[model samples]
Target: MDKAGSEKSIIALEGWLQTPAGVYMRAWEQSCLDNLTADIFGYNAVQIGMPEIDALAASRMPYKLLADRKPRAAREQQRAVNLTLDYTELPFASQSIDLVVLPHVLEFSTDPHQVLREVERVLIPEGQVIICGFNPASLWGARHVLRRVGGTSFLPRTEELISMPRMKDWLKLLNMGATQSRFGCYAPACRTEKWLHRYAFMDNAGSRWWPYLGGVYVVQAIKRVKGMRLIGPAWSRKTAAAPSAVPATNKRREQQDG
Candidate 1:
């Protein structure tokens, strides 16, 4: 999508996030991100979108930035160095950022593949990227399908839902390995907070029995650079030669003659 279209969709999403269902989804996403980003050590970390949740708050990175198209609304919701820019055309230098977080950005983008390409460009080799999105294999996803099929839209906008497998493929194409993945928020699609709370038991059950069926998923990927190897110093290799075994037997005889 163009910049104006993307911004409008995000604004609508922010409003929807104020509802009970959206509130529940945000809480689940926050918990997932807290666990995922806790150990992501780096010099610079950037959250590409979703200012409603501070994706880098738990990170210890000295430099953290939040980039989005809507800075005014983001400033109201979060406290960080915010940058207004298009996801497909990031202003940062290549391979400079150590980490990037995209929370529900792919599904809402005009060209999700291009967004991923931009993320790949700015992220340093071996850097980490954490992504959170709606799972197409979950109850919430089923509801979305039903709604769309019935000529209605329940989500913030009419966007494509990229499944986990498809996302893995995209990452693989960029030489980024999927290090870890998590799924949570196992509640049915209920509009009211009370109904959502009533089905809270599904959280525990879904975790143990059907974890992958959760409404949301978080995937952490690390960039892999080819032909990268660590080697010891040349001096160490030169000094590593061993003595000949034949010299030991003549040493005692030579000493006695001396």
Candidate 2:
């Protein structure tokens, strides 16, 4: 889709988050968070985009929220946290954040690369970044298709759902190395049975072998020091090559004699 269309789609999706379909999507997101490691525990972590989820996750860590606005429920929770500071221009100093959880913000951002760079700028060396987003090529996408065709409740114009490889490339571009990745939420479409939902792990074996096929993708990356120059360039050598030794001119002696 065109850039304008993509932006409209994202806005529509954000609005739809309050709908039944959106609630299910958010539930899936929370499920992803439930599976996250406690590595952020006791660390100065920053959660961008979703204040409600951040508020809950940060309860375990020295956490803060950075977003465009504050959720009313989050404000009511009074989670001992800061709120609504622009993520694009964060208030924290360089290398201030110990961890960052990007809960599908990049997919909706106008400049995802810039956001990643800002994330890199704030993250401490070797700091972690956990990203969660919808997989473009997965069962989730198939569900989206059903939602469209069957006229099932769904938000129109969800932004460009990026692929896992593209997301890895973005991390690499920002000097973050992928440490681990996982996929979850394997519940089949049209199967609303609670047992079926609980048995989603039946697909876990396939997920282990092909994680990219799952509905949602989660990736953890660590920032690394980049572009250090310990040694000078080879061209900086001072010595020049000496010309090949030439035969002594015997003609000079013959000329003197003449």
Index of the highest-lDDT prediction: 1
Q: Please give the CA lDDT of all the candidate structures.
A: 0.85, 0.66
| Root mean square deviation (Cα) for candidate 1 | 3.6
What lDDT tens digits, residue by residue, belong to model 2 across residues 116-200?
8889999988888889877767766676666657756332456457788899998998889998887765544423446555655
Q: What is the TM-score of each candidate against the true structure?
A: 0.88, 0.67
Query: Backbone clashes in each candidate structure, one number apiece?
Result: 1, 1
Q: Write the per-residue lDDT of candidate 1 for residues 148-206, one digit (tens) a residue.
A: 66745556664668788889999999999999998888988888999999999999999
Candidate 2: list runs displaced more than 4 Å.
Answer: 1-11, 14-28, 34-37, 55-60, 69-81, 143-156, 189-210, 227-258
Q: Return the top candidate by TM-score.
A: 1
Candidate 1, overall lDDT? 0.85
